[model samples]
Target: MNTSLKTILTASVASLFPLGAAQASEPATSGQPDTVLIQAKKISAPNVDGTSQAAALSASSDSAALLRDVPGVSLYGAGGVSSLPAIHGLADDRLRTQVDGMNLISACANHMNPPLSYIDPSHIGSIQVLNGIGPVSNGGDSIGGTIRVNSPDPEFAMAGEMLRKGQAGAFYRSNGHAHGVNLNATHASDAWSINYAGSLSEAGNIVAASPFKVVSQGNGGKPGLAGDVIGSSAYKSENQSLQMAIRNASQLLELKLGLQNIPYQGFPNQRMDMTGNRSEQLNLRYKGDYAWGQLEARLYHEHTRHSMNFGDDKQFWYGNAPGMPMDTEGKNSGTLLRAGLPLSERDQLNLGIEYQRYRMNDWWSASGTGMMMAPGTFVNIADGQRDRFGMFVEWEANWNPNWFSQIGLRAERVSMNSGPVAGYNAMAYGNPASPLSVPGAFNAANRQRADHNLDFTAVARYTPDSSFSIDGGYAMKTRSPNLYERYTWATSNTMVMNMNNWYGDGNGYAGNLNLKPEIAHTLSATFDWHSANPDQWQFKIAPYYTDVHDYIDAVPCSAASKICPGRKDGFLNLSLSNQNARLYGMDVSASALLLSTEKYGQFLGNAVLNFLHARNKDTGSGLYNIMPLNAKLSLTQHLGHWNTTAEIQMAAAKTDISAVRREMTTPGYTLLNLRSSYTWKQWRFDAGIDNLFNRFYRNPLGGAYLGQGATMGQGVPSGIVVPGMGRSLYAGMQLKF
Candidate 1:
C-alpha cells in the first residue's frame, strides 16, 4: 500500500475503533489492536488533499524508508532492502516489530535481513506505529516501541455474485537504474477467497552527488569509487505469497504461504554482502466473535538459509580460498492467542498469551589457509536456542464522556542456551603464553540462562471538546539480550571480531555472556489541537523521556579479559557491557489548509520538527548513533485528478558522538523533492525527482564506508562516511480491473 506523512498526521481519532469493539470489518479492519492504541495509522490514499501519491511511494523497495518522514523515526543505511528503523534514539532489536501478527527475528550476525525487509512495500495494506508509550499487550521484549505491518486482506463477493480483481504496476528510477514490478490477484465467493501477491526488485550501486573520499579501486567501475558510486550497494530480490481464507458471518480462518529469495544484495556500511538468502513461511490464523467478545489465534513457522561472501567491490581471494564463505540456518515457530472481553459499555479487557521457539546454527568453514584462517571450522554459534513464553492482561475504561484510561501488565520468561563452540585450529589457536582461547573459556562457561521479565503501563486520555485533547502515559518495559549479544565467542582475531560487527562502524565486537537484561522506564505525553473541521487545520506536539538500567553499550576490550588483546587505535576491539542511559525527545507538527479556489486548486501545507538527546549516564559519554535535530516541510496542491507536492528536508550537523568509538561527525545539509500524481479511469501514474538540486551531503547515521577493498583485517580504508544519493527521477504506473 502507498502511504504519506500527510495522511498519518491528519488522520481522525474515530479510526481508533478497537479490534473487537462493536462491528466487524471484512477487508479493512480496525487499525488499533485491542491492547495497543497510539492512534497512528497509515492510510492507503492521501486523504489530506483528496489525492494519492502511490506512484512516487512505490518506486523504492525498502519498506523502512516509508517511516522516513515520521516524527522521531530515522533510518540506518544498509542494503537496498535492509535498512533498519531507529525510534527515538534506539534501533535494531530494541523495537518490537511484527508482520501479520508474527514476531520475526533477524537470524544473521550482521542483521542483514531485518523484519521489515520480509514484505515488499507494494503488498503492504497498512502500517501502524506506536512511537510512544505502548501497552504491554502490544508486546514485551522491546523498549523502543511497536510497529505492525499487514498486507491487504481477502475480499469476498456479493451474496450470489463471483468476484475477480487484479492489479499490476512497475517503476523505475534513473539513479542506479533501479526498477521493479508487482502483481496481485484476488478471487473469491461469498464465504471463500484466495489471494496472491508477487514482486521483483533490483538495483545497481547508487551514486552520491560527488566523491566523499578517495580510495583504492579495482573493479573498474567509475571515478573515485565508481562514478562517485557507493560500492556494494546493489541488490536483487523476489517475493511471493498466497493466502486462502474462509469466513462464515463473523468468523474467519486464513492460511498464508510465503516465499522469498535474494540472489544478491550489497551493503555500503558492512564488509560482507548477502550472497544468498532463502526463506519460507507458513502461517495459519483464526478469528471469531462469540457472546463474550472476539477471539483470535495464530500459529506460524519460518525457516531461513542464509549465506554471506564478498560482493562485486570487496576483495574475493584470501591467500588461498577464492572467497570466505559464512553460512547460517535458523528455524522459528510461534503460537499466539488473544481474547477481547466486554464487561460493560465503559469497560473492556484484553488477554493474550504467546510462545516462541527458535533455533540457530552459524558456522564458517576453514578457508584461505592464512594467519587468521585456521585448519579447523569456526563455529560462531552452535546449536543456539532461545525460547520465550509470555502472558499479558490489559484493561480499558471510559470513566465518563470526557476521560478514558488504559492499564496493562505483562509477564514473560526467556530461556537461552547454546552448545559448545570452537575456533579455527581448536588446539593451536589457544595462546598458552597469554591465555586460553575464548572458545575454551566460552565452552566452559555456563551458557544456560533464564530471565523472568515483567512489564507495566498506564495511560489516560482527556478530551474536553472535539477541538482539543491530551494523552499521557508511563511505561516500564524489559528486554532480554538477543542471541548474538550474549553468544558470540570469538574475540582474539580481528577478522573474527569483524564478522560480528552489526553497527557498520568498521569496528570489531565481542559478546559478554554475563550481560544483564535491559530495563527501561519511559514517560510520554501528547497534546493535540485542531480546528472544528480537521481538514481546515491541525497541530500537535509530543514529548518523551526514558531512563534505562543495564543498557547494552560497548566497552573497550580490557587486558584483564585475556581473550582479545592488541586493540588498534582507530579500529578497536570492543565487548558489549551494561551501562546506564537516558534519552529525551520531542516532536512538533502542524498542518493547515493553504488555499482553495475553483479557478486554481486546493493547497495544503504540513511541517514537522524533531529533536533528540541521549547520554550514557554511567560513564558521562554521548551515546552512539543518536539522530540529530531534523525537520520536514511540504506544500501540496490538488486539482481534480492531478496532485503535486514540493518538499524540503533538513538536518543539523552531528557533533555529539561516542568518544570511545572515535565516531566521525557529519555536516548538515538540505535537499528538495518534487512529486506529482495523476489518475484516470482505472489507472494511476506517479513521478518524482529526488534530490532535485543535487545536494551533496553525508548521512550522519550511515556509519563508515566499508563497501569495497580488502575488509578482512583493517586493509579496507576507514574514516569515510557513507554519502547520500544524488539527483534521481523516478516514475511508476498502476492499473486495476
Candidate 2:
C-alpha cells in the first residue's frame, strides 16, 4: 500500500517475467536528435531527451479520461459524459488544450465542450503535456498547463514498403456496454502517400453509489442534499471523428473533421433533459522542410449547439423541490490560423493570429402552474458578434548545440457587444419588480464592451551531450473575465447554497460587469539523463512552480454592500481584486531493460512517479484539484509478431490542500491493466482491459459534493463528485492489402 513496497514489488517481480517487461530496443538509425526516445509498446511521444513526460495517451474512451493519467491534471465530472479536466486546480477558460495546433475553447457556463471534449482519443497518435509554461510555440494561456494532441502520422514513410506497403486496419472495443470503433487506411507509392482514419463510440449510464441513505430534513441533524439515494444514476454519450493526411519526406498536409452528439436522459446535472447538444469541428494544416529551416501553417473552426427541455418527467424539480418546467438552446463558434517559419539556421521563429465569435439564444415554454410563475420566457443572452484578434511570435536561438534559448510574445484584443441578458426573477422573494412577481416580463438590458491583453514567455535549454540535458522557463500571461461573470441577472436559487459562506443562496444575487482579466507568472525546470545505449537504463526529472496575480474568486455579499441586494447574505457580484497563488511539483520517470535478445525479442521495465503541491498566496491554503502523489509501473514484451504488456498504477492517500473549502479526499488505490497484441503477415490486432479489478473510489471533486450535504445535484454540484468508471475491456485490429 505504501510507495516503497509497491516499487520494490513491481521491480523485483515484474522485471523477472518477460510478460511484465517492455520491449525496448535500439533505434533503427542514429544521428537523430531524439536519441533517447521512450517508445513503450502501447504509447508514443517525443521523450524530451530520454525524459518521459507522463501523458495519458490512449484511445480515449472519453477525452477528459486521457488527462486523468497526466500528473497534476484532474477532471471535474458530474459522474458522467459532461466532465471537464482541471489542471493544477485551474479549469474552464483558465487552461488551454490544443489538437494539431488548433485551440478548442468552451462556451458553456457549466463547461460542456472543454478542450478535450472535441477530441476522440482513439484518433490521436500521441499526446504531449507541459505541466506549466512549457513551450511558447505551444501558445501561452496556460496559467496551469498545456496539452497538445497529435494525430497519428504515416508509418510507412519511415520504415519502407516491405514492412507495410498497402495496409488498412480497423479496431473495436467495448466497456460496460459502451462500444467504440476505428478504421484506418494507408498507401505508399515511392514518394507521395496518404493516410485516413475514422472512429465512432457510444456509451450508456454510469453506475454510482446506490441505496445510500441520509436524513431527509435538516434540524439538529446533518443537512444532506438528498434524503435517501434511489437507484444509481446512468450516463450515455456518442462521438465520431475523421482524419485524412497527405505526406512525403519533405512536406505534409492533413485535414481533420469531427462531430460529437450527446443527449442524456434521466441523468444527473440539470432539471431539464439535454435534448440535442452537438459539436462540429474542422481543421487543416500544412508543414514542409525548407532550405533555411522549416515552415508550417494551420487553420481551424468549430461549432457547438446545445438544447435543453423539460417534459412530463418529474425529475424537473426546482430548488430541490418539485416546481416549474423549463427549456432553452445555446451555440458557440470560432476560427484560428497559425504559421511558423525559421528565420535563420541558429534562430527559428513562429507567428500566429486568430479570430473568434460566440452567441446564445434560448426560448422557454412553461405551462400549467409553473407557467404562471414565468410564462413563455424568451431568455436571450448573446455576445452578438463578439470578436478577438491575437498575434504571437516565438524565436529560438542555438548558442551552439550545447545551449539554446527561446522567447515568445503574444498580444490580443477582444470586443464584446450584445444586448443585456433578460430573464424572469423566477423567485417572488421580497421585491415587487422580481421576475417571479411580474410574470412574462423582460427585466435584463442589452450591452457592449471591448478589452485587450498581452502575454509573454521565455525558455532556455542546455545539453552538455547527447546523454543529458536541462531546461528552464518563465512566462507572464492574462485572461479576460468571462461574460457570464459580468452580466448575469437572475435571483439566486435558495436551494443551491454556496459552501464557502453557508448562506449565499436564494436571498438575491447580482453581477459585476467591470471585472478585469486574471494575470499569471510561471517558472519551470527539467533535467534528463540517458545511457549511451539506453536499451539498458534511463532517467528523467522535472520540477516546476507558478505564481499567479489577480486570481479570481467569488464570495457572498451582505445586502448593505455597494452592489444591489446589499442587505442580503447571498451570491452578489463580490470579487477579490488583488489575489495571488503558487503551485510546485516534480515528476520522475525511469526505465531499465531487463532482457533483450533477437530470438526472444526484447523485455524492458519502466516506472513514472509524480508529486505536486499548490497553494493560494492570499490565504496560504491548498489550491483546488491538485493531484495526489502517484506512480505507474509498466512492462512490455515482444515475440516477433506477438506482444504483451501489463501495468500497475497507484495513487497515494490525499490530504486537503484547499483548506476551509472542503475538498474530497481519496484513499490510496492500486489498479492493474493488461494488454496483448499480435501481427500476422500484414494484419495486426490488439486487446486490453482497464481497471481490471473494477475498483471503486471517488475523486476529490466528487468527494467535495458529498461533504456539502446541501442541494447537491443542482447546476453547480451536479453529481460531479462521484467516482469514475469501473473495470472495462477493449479490443481492436488492423489489416493491410
Candidate 3:
C-alpha cells in the first residue's frame, strides 16, 4: 500500500501528533572516549534524568512507562511488568528494543515478558527512542524504530581514592495493593568499579471504577470473580544484577550478570497466566579509542525457562482436565561490533556487524495429573531456531552549522527452522477436519525458511537559527516474521490456537507457514519553534506517513477451527496472513516556563497531543491495538527542594477497529494525576494520586477481557473491554547512604 501525499495532507486535521525532535550529530572518530553514544545518531531520553522519580512513583510497575512522553510511542496492555511498546502503530517484534546492548527475544507464546521487563527502572541510566527515520546503523530487522535502554556506567573515584555509595527506595500504590522495593550499591576505585542493583515488585487484582462484566462460576464450587475487580491482573517479579567495569586511559571493559524471577504474572486478556518464569544473562563488552576511530564490541547470552497455567482467577477443574499447563524454554545469544571512523573534519562513518542466534521450545503437559489430557505430551513447537546476521554502514556529515545529513544502508539475513510437533492424542478432537491430523500435515511440510532484507535511511536536519529547526527524512525498513507468526501450527484446533494469541484480543490465531517479510517506507519530519534560552518555551510538531507491504494480519480460518459454534457475540478463529497497511500520524508537544520568582517559585507547563490513523489496505479495516487521539498536559512547580506536578490525560473514543480481529471500542475519558516530591540531602520522598476522580474508562489498547472463567473453550463471553485503573494513591521514599 503506497499512501499518496494528497491522502496524508487530506487527513491533516485529525491525523498527526508531534512530540519532540532529534538532532543528527556527526559521529566521533577520535579525540573522545568510546561511549554507548557512538552511533551516527544521538537520541536522548524523555527528561534530563533517565527513569526519573515520576516513573518510579507512578502506580504502574511496568518500566516501559518511561517512554510515555516520547513521540510516536504507546504501550499495549499486558502483565504488570511486561507492556509491549508500539512505535508509530507498529509493535512487538516490529520494533528493535535493546537492553544493555543485548537484543532479547520474548520466549513465551503469549509474549508476557518483553525485553524491557528484564531491567528494572532503578538500574537504568538512559533510555532513547528513535522513530522510523533513524540511521540504519542504529539497528536492523525492524520497521517501527529503535529503543535503547542502557544501564548506568561505572563511576570511579578520583585518583588514589575509593568510592562507596548505596541507595534504597520503596513504594506503594493503593489501587491494586501494589508495592515494591529497590536497592543499588556501588564500590569502585580509580581503576575498577563494582555495582549491584536489585528490585522486587508485587500486585494484586486491580479494582475497576465500576462493575463491567459478569464472570463465570468456576468448577468445583469455585466462585466467580467480583464485578468490580479485574481478574488475572496480579503479578510478582524480582530482579538482581551485578556489574564490574575495568577501564584505562583509552579503553573500558565491562561485565554484567543479570537474574530475573517472575514467580507469577496474570494477564487479564489471555487465557493463561505466567505461573513461573526465570531468566539469566551474562554480557561482556569492550570499548576502545584509537587514532583513526572508536570501536565497541559486545557479546551476550540469555536463557529463559517459563511456565504458564490457569491462575486463581480462572477455572481449574474441567471435568477430567484439572488444569492446563504450558511451558516454553528459550536461549538467546548475540554479538555486536560497531566502529566510528572519521573521514574528514566534517564527516564521520559508522560501521556495524551483528549476529544473533535464538532457540526455543514450547510444549504442553497433560492435565489432571495425566488423567484429563491423556494421549501424550502436546508439542506446540519443537526445537525452534532463528539466526540473524547483519551489517550496516552509515555516514553522518556536518554541513556547516545550518545543515546536517545522515545516510545509511543495512542488510540482514534471517533463517528459521522448527522441528516436528504433535498433539496430545492421535484421534480426532471433534473437529470436522480432525485437529489431530493437522499435526502430521504440518510436520510433513517444509519447515525451514529464510529471508534477506535490505534497509536504507536518509535524514536531514536544518537549523537556520537557534530559535527554529526542522528535521525530516525518508526510511525504508524491513522485518522478518517472528517465530510465533510463522511456526504456530494446528489450524484445526481452536484450543491450541487460543493459547497462541499475544494480542489478548480473545481471538484464536494459527500461524501460516507461507509468510513474507514486511517492508515499510516512511516519510517523517519534525518542526520546532522555541525560545533560544534553555527551558524557556518550546513547541514541536511531527507528521509522519508509512506504507507497509506484506504486513502480517489475519484471515478467517477453516471451519474446523471454530470454537463451539452458535455462541452469541463470540470471538473468531483466524490464520495469520500477509497484507498491506498504511499508517499516518502527527504529534504536537510544547513546554513553557510559566512563572519564575525568588519570592515564590518556578512554574512550568507542558503539553502533548497525538493522533494516528492506520488501516489495512488489503482489507480496508483499521489496524489493531493502535492508540486513538490523545493528549497529556501537565503543570509543574518547584519551590525550595520540593517539586509537584498536576497532569491531565485525555483520549478520544476509539471507534475505528479491526473487524477481522473483532476489536473492541473504548469511550473517551479524562484522568487527572497529581504527584509531589521533596528532596532533603540524601533523602527523597514522593506522593501521587492517579485517576483522582475515580473516573470510569476503558483502555484503548486493553484488548478484550478474558481475565477469568473457562477461557480454554469459549466458556467466557465476549464484548467486554478491559477497564482502566481508578483512584490510586501512591507514596515512595528513597535514601542514600
Top candidate, metric lDDT:
3
Residue pair clashes in candidate 3: 16-585, 16-586, 17-586, 17-587, 17-588, 18-587, 18-588
lDDT of 3 by residue, 156-218 (tens): 899999999888888999989999998889999999999999999999999988889874565
lDDT (Cα) of model 3: 0.81
Give each model's whole-structure lDDT: 0.79, 0.52, 0.81
What lDDT tens digits, residue by residue, belong to model 1 across residues 1-737?
A: 12343345435522331111110011121111111112431111010111113543454788777667667788998899999988888888898888887888888888998898898877777666765477787768988887777777778999898999888888999998999998888999999999999999999989899877665567435333654888899999999999999999899999999999999999888879999999999999999999989999999999999999988788887777667788989999999999999999999998999999999999988887765666778888999999999999989898997888888899999999999887777554553223355677777788999999989888888777676767878888889999999999787677888889788887888888888999999888777666667676667778889999999987877722535756553677788888999999888766677677997777777777889999999788889888789998888777888878888999999999987776789999999998887778777787999999999988988988888877775566667888889999999877787
User: Which TM-score value belongs to model 3?
Assistant: 0.92
> Could you tell me the TM-score of candidate 1?
0.92
Candidate 2 per-residue C-alpha lDDT over 196-279 given as tens digits, one digit per residue, 9 for 90 to 100 = 555555544443333233433432343323422311233345555555666776888877777777664322333233455677
| Runs with alpha carbons beyond 4 Å of true place in candidate 3 | 1-55, 215-224, 369-372, 429-436, 558-569
Give the Å shift of residue 629 in candidate 3.
0.5
Question: How do all models score by TM-score?
Answer: 0.92, 0.75, 0.92
Better of 1 and 3 by lDDT: 3
Q: Estimate the overall C-alpha local distance difference test score of candidate 1.
A: 0.79
